[model samples]
Target: MKKKHMARGTGALVLVTGLAISAIGNPAHAALSGQALVNSKCATCHEAKTDQHWTRIGESRRTPEGWDMTVARMTFAHGVKLSSEERGAVVKYLADTYGLAPDETADHRYIIERTPSVVEHPESKPIGDTCARCHSYGRIAVQRRTEDDWRKLVHFHVGQFPAIEIQAGGRDRNWFEIATGDVAKELGKVYGYDTASWKQWQAQKHADASGVWRLVGNRPGVGAYEGKATIARTGDDRYSVAMVMRYENGSEESAKGSAIVYTGHEWRATLKQGGRDIHQVFSLGANGAELNGRWFEANNDAVGGTMRAVRADKGVPASVLSVQPAMVRAGMRTTLAINGVGLNGEVNLGRGVKVIKLVEQSAERIVAEVEVAKDVASSSRDVQVGRASGAGLLKLYKQIDYVKVLPQHPMARVGGNGGSQPKVPAQLEAIAWAAGPDGKPGTADDIRLGAVPAAWSVDNLNKMAAEMQDTKFAGRIEQTGLFVPNGAGPNAERKYKTNNAGELKVTATVKDGSRMVKASAPLIVTVQRFNDPPIR
Candidate 1:
């Protein structure tokens, strides 16, 4: 990972990221393994142990990016010089030796995925208002540390970011004491270094990642895609990958790259597709039965899709991966696109639905048209094709009562214009909500109809925004629900020569029959963010 600096700000003052992974141990830095290099170089400040471990280095564990940030911080703050090759080796070494268990990172995958416009609600308000204000709750939860180490981290934060005492809610009380005494204690209990999952993971045998994988996922704003990935072992813990994917419109794209498998399960691949750099962060499932993760643009984390893949050979079981839309209205005719591995035989959709037309059927995909009974009860429906079955793959609903916008509150940044910083855009989607059995909207029983087509537009958020004509200057929302922010830099034509910044409302208008269902989300368009660490 390259060095990225957290700018000088109230939140960035805390040393969360902007760390550079440097060379470890030997001065010549040649002909040495990653561990030996780390053991040699890190001992300068951190005391080396008899068992080839360092003081604080072995006291905590994190993901690859977390280790990258820690080492990068050493390079940035402590002036450690690290080469890209050395950084990769050391990161691989440390991540494999001291990495979080898959179970530990289950709830915090969003941070690893670098998802955008997420509103995190930390279980503890103090942690949310204090530490999370600087980064994300997932960034904190992704690491496991001992109680003593946690306490020491609090002290380090106070020493580095003295403004922590005055930043937002930090000024209200004794922040240091609360952080060291209570917060650290809570974090230790929740994110303890010694966990059974980690122990089991370390002891368990690792599966090889060389095989043909059937991939199925949806590219946001685009459509559904089904593909195949061929992985071949190239070296120790590394493989060469090739993927060919076909979208719903019959268009195809292929990507080829080299991948590194970390901690047995974490699969990281850097590839080129359609003349653009891309990356895949997927986890190889048990016995290499399945691979799950996402692929995103190298420069933009928000532009990506959810990926689920199953092994295509080596006696992999027949599986029904997914059923598109998932939900259908009663008394309606729907076309279902089924994606899976080795799909064949009978097509079964639980009660009140029957296949009327078989558009296409193959070993990997099956397209069928089905008719839904009008009197069918609203309930969960299973989908099965031959030996493969997916539970609760379909939901029977009566009507769509309303529409809603995801990421109810979002933030966009202006950037680019013969500059380095790229503009950050908003990927918005409109969802149709069905009033479930209770027939009342906004209840727990409401069902989601996924992404629906909508006319996108932006308006001033409030009186001040209206007076400033914020919508006119901020950016434009495309018809496909994509909000592209304006370029960075000050506009001399604007009042006070301010940059293109505004508080706007993103509105999605969906035409359902004669009724026009509409929904709105607040969007804040601001100046460029200079500090963008992977974990943020």
Candidate 2:
């Protein structure tokens, strides 16, 4: 066996042992390549033993964030010292080499994009009981491992948590046996390390990201935005992003950022908008023709929204993705911004809606002032931009009979009193609802009139919360429907002297005509989430 000594901290050294293998996968120039760093640094820990691949690591695969957390665990738990650049390289190398296929992660994209308030329930109960009962089902679903590796993982969990079997669900049966016998096999079958999909991915050609792209999405507090993004290749798999966003309110803003693409399709970027930092987690579409995911605030992950982009290069199909000011109040002249690709032609807002004026025109966007007739029925309208038609893109509403808060309930944490985890704020939106043909709000035919401005407030959730005065201590809701949690700690004065956690309810009041429509949702502000892995 060849021994390699690696220095950690100041004087300590870790001894690495590995036998010579017939073949080795070479990591390229480290400064320009992540594989190189993996060979020079990570090789000391994960020995190359099986079939010229690293031992335990070679048989396992994960998403970029999963690999990132694994590397971060080394830095935090093993006292391994790595510069941020070096760490990123290692993660990139591992993820690219042993990354999951695009379809493998398709079902769990919400967690990858840091989407707020996602509740995932896997189809299998044994898998759920054995693994997901502790963490997110997505964490297990997006990962690949061999049957032996799965068993080894189960053992490791028991070794670390000790009484995990008893603590996980009910201790009615042989939990350990079930985990090793049934759960491991099921996990291996569902998330096999060597699959036909991975083989196809390995042989497929990935598209370059440098080019022009059409973009559209709705930001919660702000209205819908239509724009274009230009990406230029700065280095291998790295891009410099420049974007021009035209909000429906006739306001425009530009942003620039840096991004690194992992595993070909996984695109992660960090950008600043109006001087506030934001992050983008997107999946490049098949053939690099499009991308979809979410962009979020750097300081607060919950305070962001969804975005989708399509390659607008030459010969691309004309497609209409979204329309700005989607909700046109009856009897109002609203300028609708139609955003998409290859945009050109007469703008149609269905019957009873006339395009009185064309404000602006471009290949990516068309702005037109349209007047909605006062007698127009409340229903979803199809928008036709030139040859591209988007069904249900426009919603014309005559009245808002009710308002419903997006994310009816969500879990938040109290933090920032010198705690490691930052507070998880909840951003809510009050969406107006029309009775539609059903003449009732909760029916399947109800038409959503999009988001409307609302007054935000919080109240005690229940009798226990009211008795404890939880609303007085929990947090404050901004006029924009953003809930900023109070600092974490045990209070000195109060009943029972507890932490600032609270059971609360959030209310969004929308003023429609003279009647006030209010919608309330549950909000549980409690102790910090014990773990928030990238997959979770």
Candidate 3:
């Protein structure tokens, strides 16, 4: 979603005050209760009954961030106006009363957590084709709203993407009508804001999230890093943070940022690191002892990593934070170092992995030379130091059952020098995963054995793709999965005089035992990115 920037000016405030007076008969403004404030400000345009329930207001719940966006939209798009204090009270009231149910967010955590290489399928076919066609379903499912708001959102879409009405399913029937009518109502019913869960959560005491924390994070292309963060409360549920990190290669960096914690558990931060903006979306653990989330480059959502933070003073148990060269090839001997806290005593590197020699030992780290058996089956195993165990922290794999294409669904822009814009290529990586004992594709037992050598190829996803001559015009995928798109603009060499865009499929095949296992993901050859935000 595009970020909304609030307009600032005395003129805008004056305009808002005049609108407020016209909407609600009251000219005097005072510190009103949340309900009273909503009744006076929002209920003027939105219908409100005697029970204090506003038509659209009573039907939905949202995070503080979501409510903030909504209020901004109302002021900018609908001409709703209120003082800063009034806006805060309204947002707080709405978020507190109408926030997300834990159950509602359970299935869609992958988006919030930004787990890498994840492929999500929509729950309904209509939603998949209509809503998820342009973006992820998580973006849609994450918010709650009333039928009116849902309808308004549909209108907003039609206004923004005028061609949507004539595209694919949109042209199949009364798409706009259905989307603004039954579909909107259905969405409101399923993802409505009011729920018993919100009430329960609102009544519970929230943990204070202020203090020093130890952080461990992994960026896909950059490897792993360790850091420390010091946070100080700035306002109610808001904080300022400073952090420093050290990469595996001894490179160091630092950042300063601020964060807002919505619903007391959702922590979102914007930090300036290495002169670039970064967005961190994390969930404060129930106990408030840990923070688990993802941090990404604000302009490119794909360039991010899994992040975890633990309270520095909580006296955490001995745990392995990371292992150098996380994965090793079968039959190869390598020196491995396990880094973490309270590391001592003899370390066990799991079965099929034998320690060749102890290279180093300390209270916070352990290094040893290890060897892996060539015939060992691929799987993640536990690494132990006395009684403290890191389960599934180490892997000893001999073969890969399937390969995953990173950024599973990627868009490659056609290259050109006309606008002095070099074509943006998609850097793809094929990660190998070892099938579990069951030899199944989807199961908890499946283990990511890490990046491995694989043969790469591109093809058409369907008959229409083939008819479009995607194989001939879309571009090509190298043996390493790096996709370089065709030149931009209309091509006289092709049947259709249009930009060489097409729907393509990327496949990675690997040799596993006596069989060849392969995996495929979708790709789109398209135009260049114009406004590249840090997170998309």
Candidate 4:
């Protein structure tokens, strides 16, 4: 999700701050003192003796990215102008002095580490109701700021989302006042920037991040993948990376990217994968032994997963990364390839799956033609190589009894140039999982059988959707579960006489044994997204 900002606003505080900062004539290469710079540029509006204004600034710290964002907002929204060199000096000073205490981020490291499929929320009720209503709590908790900055954030919300004051719990008496006052103060007290941790972190030496590494990642509904990455230092704090990944379904993808490390910890990258842009956010472990974070599609934050990389020399023994064509229809003959390491001996393609021919064999890979019996039941079993002594690294499923539409709550935008901008379509997928013993649904024991063939369709999700005729106006779903939305311009012929946007239900059905098992997922067809960040 994109961070909202005030579009237009003016107040006595803004005027004073602008004039005071501008009054300090631009200087050429004055000694880079953070305090002196702040006194000349900000003290007029903040008044150092106010206790909650300039004094608060002196007491708080933040990450380099955090400080950069704040400085950018001040320049563009609050008229705090500075030369490029002065801006850099100011950011460096603030980040180095008022940065996050090492212990401050210990509990919430997952926010920067990007642990996959984890759900987190703030313990505070008001924070949950107000802040988390639009974005993840981790986004708010990961940053360190002063009470003054926190108060500004509250005002920023009010200016950007005016309806927030009258929405749900926000409608309570003095909601806005409390948010800009007590709530901000409390947050600053708990998440303050200055601490012994930051001092210690700043004094310690950081590890160099350019090297070869081994990586493993897991995307929900997409299974697991493993790869090798080569990182080369391109600048003092920038790196270029090349990676090759093999997915559980036997597909291989190559990616190239560049990254900038901030404050010696945050790793942000822009990568290209399969002709599409992907953004990555990772944290370099203090020990320099690993980099843990998340990578997602640049257009959609929801389509991402956990990423972990360790020095290649420190990685574990060779093992199977994934099996190609993990699932196959029973009674059909197809070529199967097992890709991994240590595959020198005879291969077993599991029970109920017959090995028709051995086309190729090697210590690290094997290719064979296999056939499943018509009477085989829908089940998953491991594939072993080199008999019982060899490694069992693959799973072959004979049937798909159930289908799940991935991204349970999908949001797709209508496409057209008529509105703010043309929208991007959403790609969907259907995953097949084998039901466990007793045929119960939604159990922990259910085995993911990988992607399978399924029929797809769309319908209105509610009365509003039906009245809007979304099924007709919106896009259609392909057999592969991809949703292609319609244009965004107004259509006088439609019932709503607006763009093709509404709530939709996408269903996927597959034949399991003799019965058809199906799953439906909610989808929202909406307006164009303006800010598409790497991680939401």
Q: Which stretches of candidate 1 lie over 4 Å from their true place?
A: 1-32, 285-287, 325-327, 377-380
Candidate 3 residue-wise lDDT, 1-536, digit = tens: 11222221111111112122212111233334555676777887888754346776766666554565567567767777776656655665565456665556767777655454457787766666666665567766777776688788899889967898887556777888878877887777766655566666656788788998777776654556777889998665667889987766578889998775666677777788878888787778566778887877664454567778777655567766667667776798998877666666778877788899988997556788999888777677777876667777777666665678777777777767475345655656667776777878568888887755567788997888898788898788776556778877678777667777888888878776677878788888878666331111
Residue 293 in candidate 3 has what lDDT? 79
Candidate 4, residues 1-536, lDDT tens digits: the string is 11212111100000011112211112233445544566677676557853223654654555554565566557766787665555555555555445564456556665554343335657676666656655567667767776777888788788977887787566656878888877887777766545566666767777788988767776544556777788998654557889887776668888997765655666667788767777677778676767877787764544666677766553334444445676776687888876555555666766778888889986455789988887676566666776433233433455565677766567778866565455655556677877666566568767677665677889999998888888998888776566778888787878857878879998888776687878898888888665432122
Residue-pair clashes per candidate: 8, 0, 8, 3
CA lDDT, candidate 4, residue 263: 58
Q: Estimate each model's TM-score.
A: 0.91, 0.88, 0.71, 0.68
Instruction: At residue 326, give the lDDT of candidate 4.
Output: 67
User: Which pairs of residues have clashing backbones in candidate 2?
Assistant: none
Q: Candidate 2, residues 1-536: lDDT per residue as tens digits?
A: 12323211110001001211111111232353455555666668878674226777678898877777666766765676666656666666667778877887888888777778877778678888778877788778878999999999899888877988888564877888998998899988888788988877867887799999988888887778878899998766778899988777778878888777777888888787767778788889657888788988876788887888898888788888898777877898887778888888888878999999999998777879889999988889888987888899999887898999988777678988888668888888899999888677789899988889999989999999999898998889899888888877787765899888999999999998888999989999988764655556
Better of 1 and 3 by TM-score: 1
Pairs with steric clashes in candidate 4? 1-536, 61-98, 62-98
2 against 3, candidate with superior TM-score:
2
Each prediction's whole-model lDDT (CA) = 0.77, 0.78, 0.68, 0.64
Best by TM-score: 1
Evaluated at residue 236, the lDDT of candidate 1 is 62
* Lowest lDDT block of 10, candidate 2: 8-17
